[model samples]
Target chain A: MAVEILKENYAGKVLSMTIGVGDRAVTVGGATALPFHSFEGEVGNRPLIAYEVLDTVPEDPPASLQEELESVWDDPVKWAKYCQDEQGARAIALRLVSTDPDGQDASPESAAETVKKVLDAIDIPLVILGCFKEAKDGPVLKAAADAARGCNCLIGKAQEENYKTIAAAATANGHKLIAFSNLDFNLAKQINILLSQADFDINNIVTDPTASALGYGLEYTYSVIERIRAAGLMQNDAMMQPPMFLDLSSVVWKVKEVKASEEDLPEWGDRTERAVHWEAATATSLLMAGAEIMVMTSPRAIQTVEKTIDQLMA
Target chain B: MLLIGERINVITKAQRAAMEARDPKPIQEIAKAQVEAGATMLDINIGPAEDDGPQLMDWIVKTVQEVVQVPLCLDTTNLDAIRAGLKAHNNEWGKPMINSTSGETVRLNTFMPVAAEFQCDIIGLCLSGSGLPADANERCAIAVDIMGKAAEVGLPIENIHLDPLVLMLNGNQEQAMHCINAVEMFQTLNDPPMKTVVGLSNIANTAPMEMKGILTAVFYKMLVDAGLSGAIIDTLEKDFMEVVRTGDPASVYPAEHVEKTMKVMRGEIMYAHSFLEV
Candidate 1:
């Protein structure tokens, strides 16, 4: 008897969306089978990793995240340029953290200026993330989206509360919108449907179905991502077909394993290595769960993630 | 699951009486009830009681469509009756389906073009006349041939769903495993998997009444793992439909998800707040 491999012929493929313009532009999704099930179908693009940069000065972004880019930490443009030019970043995720109503409370105009400087300095793709505060997200994200016009960037995180204004901005600027739903499958689908109702085509969309840190309820996040992928591939669902965007570092860095100090807890191992491993492990787990793009902060973690991808995809 | 509810046929006592009287109420009630019970398609089979079978099939098709918005699966052995149902079909929902054809020479020659000409989907029974194949490999070959013939008539292979006939597992235990293998092999016939189904109630035809539901549901779950995408079953069986809904965990989840989903399957986790509520 011959042993046959269990391979699926997925009815639907993930929507392949192109980010950035010119030679360095990246295209993600287009797997007619499950992730890395190469015997059955083709995986069009490898997962993309974008180094995260903040518009506000980094008051504190974990000590492990700090040392990786100590030289470029002072300036957002320097940080974005350094990640693109020096680190060979295929994409840059510029988070407008200062525009939050409760944080630094910077005006939308200043955030847009930061966006313009980074857009002018980098040739790679950009994913502009809003501060996610309900009161100020509409104005700030609109300014950032307007600033990155014609760049073919991914502008997003349209939550239920502020999706209307963000959807308008993303469509008007001709960029993909990232709809965020808090770890619930129906809400993720509902928000995408909601975005489509606002006249944004469902194809020009990415989804963040709420990232959970590796140790803290990671299984729930894993299951949700799997459900999304299955609905798209096996079930031929359009609303669930967008490439998953795992915003890992924001949650991973704040977790116990990634932030606990070596001196504070010696048996937990080296603080820097542990944090890098935490980010890489969280990313790899989600990639297997069907993430197409991930936003991460540590260079060492990105290296490990690339290595893991190579090993699995090889 | 593309559940074609099998309870509307004149083979049942109430259905026969209603068809004999030319009354539309019973047919209409079954149509509305099946649709409400989560059936995507209803199979209309007008039995031999009526000499005006074609006209009655047309009436049944029209009556069902009036009550429900789902596509109808015209279920009859006679080509003319199938045509009448197809003629009366008002595709307010989508293209309707033909219950089936087989790799038998007469079937492939007659039914393939009817499906293509009408632009309707069909079920391809994986049989070539003598009987259900003794093994999975032979059944797969016949399914492939049926698909090829359907394609020759300009019917895209996807429009042809192959049903590797579900055999009675009471005395023929080996046939159960063969059906599972055939279902899995049907997927390899196309790049995106040719649709496949099991005539679910046929598996328990010889079993006792209480055992029928349990046996069919277990077999249905197994067939789903083997890539069965549709079924011809009693939609009134709420527990069976639930099995169909929750079938095939491997295709839908990671290992960790399977662990949690298994608990959901076993009723250990009732209010699972995840979007996995199929």
Candidate 2:
């Protein structure tokens, strides 16, 4: 089957962003073409994957992941260190999950402490995320941003509700911010615009157009990220040019396909292997759709994605 | 809508006094006010000052720039004044606007090179060697000629704005529709559509002062729907400007049917431009 290659000549380049300060600092974006259409324009930095670490310990981890993290699962700092060193992760994302008002309601001070310890342990860049609660996330993320100061870490989840405080914190501390908006590409651009309107530098902002898990409306996220990349590259739309973050773990983990037991359906293969493959598949799809940074939890999936990236760059 | 505020002109009796005194205060005040109300460019017309045109214009440019950094439209009949104004412009905000040139062969050599040299945005009038053509097709023929001359000077075609001059409805009803026709015709002359602009207030020139608002609202809506891109408008006229704002959501959208219909019906917003307020 002979298929003609359709190429697009785009007018703009995505904003090149570098997170972290020194040798381990990673750079993403600066691509002028569609994600991997190197046949036409340019794709500068390769996509990066960051391992997830929670401020509060997880109540339950799958047996496959549990056995690997037996020593560090209870402590975010040690878990972050383990991912950076032993797991050979590229970056570590510190999720302030306990800061949700409905959850453990962890103090901002404790989250800050967790951030400091984790920053100290990892040589790779750090990504500090917050609970979905807008009001609670601002103080918690602001504390985390302050703690990770000078590490050149990425701090955010700056939704419309809390972008001002988070933007202020990021600017004051000299860190990168992640502007989050529900899957609409325009909303993502609008939130970034609002942040810039408040005098925040757009170059330091990353967009999160809301990720979706594999087999669970992933196409929506896939299309939006593709549109965002096209808008930035083809329309010269500066508002949409910020590097995108497709945080993959939470959304991919909670889905049924990644959790269903093999015993329930004998024709299906091993459940653990299926879940890891699911993570790898979803991450790669988004990466190809123009996500520059992603967060995931599995070591095996990281290997799969690393191999995938090698083939893609080839 | 690409709105160019038309209030800073020296034609008005109040403005002439301020310019004559070299007072930057009132011009600054108008600049700030127009920007606040969302005028993208402020048209600076120093009317009929050929003797002191250059000196007066250079002064006004500095005066307006002192307060607001917004781009200024250099409106004048004097070529030397344009040169003086361009010299005085800082361009920190953006390119200065050449408030106009026409297809008239006699004026092209004078204005086009000035525009090309300074790379100012040029608003090209549809009037040719003989002056305002009888019909829309003739206007576009002149527009095509203007575009050719502009291209010869290496000015990007996109920067050219074509104003197919508006005529008063009271004297010639045929030319009223003809003006709107020219706007539509001019837009089709290029791939990216040459921008259509109009001195919006001129269409109501002979209208009774009380009726100017209604006349402008009705015809301005027609020109806008016919593909007017920019307008030299009084941003101070809130109702008329609002009508321009909501006239067409955008080109991809058909001219807003309901609002256009309402303005024609003389609905609630129709009185929005009435003389009672003035």
Off by over 4 Å in 1: B1-278
TM-score, chain A only, candidate 2, equals 0.96
As a whole number from 0 to 100, the lDDT of residue A45 in candidate 2 is 89
DockQ of each: 0.02, 0.01
How does model 1 score by TM-score? 0.55
Q: How many Å off is the CA of A177 in candidate 2?
A: 0.3
Worst 10 residues of 2 chain B by lDDT: B269-278
Clashing pairs in 1: none
Error of 2 at A62 (Å): 3.7
**Which 10 residues in a row give candidate 2 chain A its minimum summed lDDT?**
A59-68
What are the per-model C-alpha RMSD values against the true structure? 18.5, 20.1
Candidate 1: tens digits of C-alpha lDDT, residues A63-128 = 888788877977889999998888888999999988887778999999999999999999999999
lDDT of 1 by residue, B227-265 (tens): 789998888887677666676433333446555433433
How does model 2 score on DockQ? 0.01
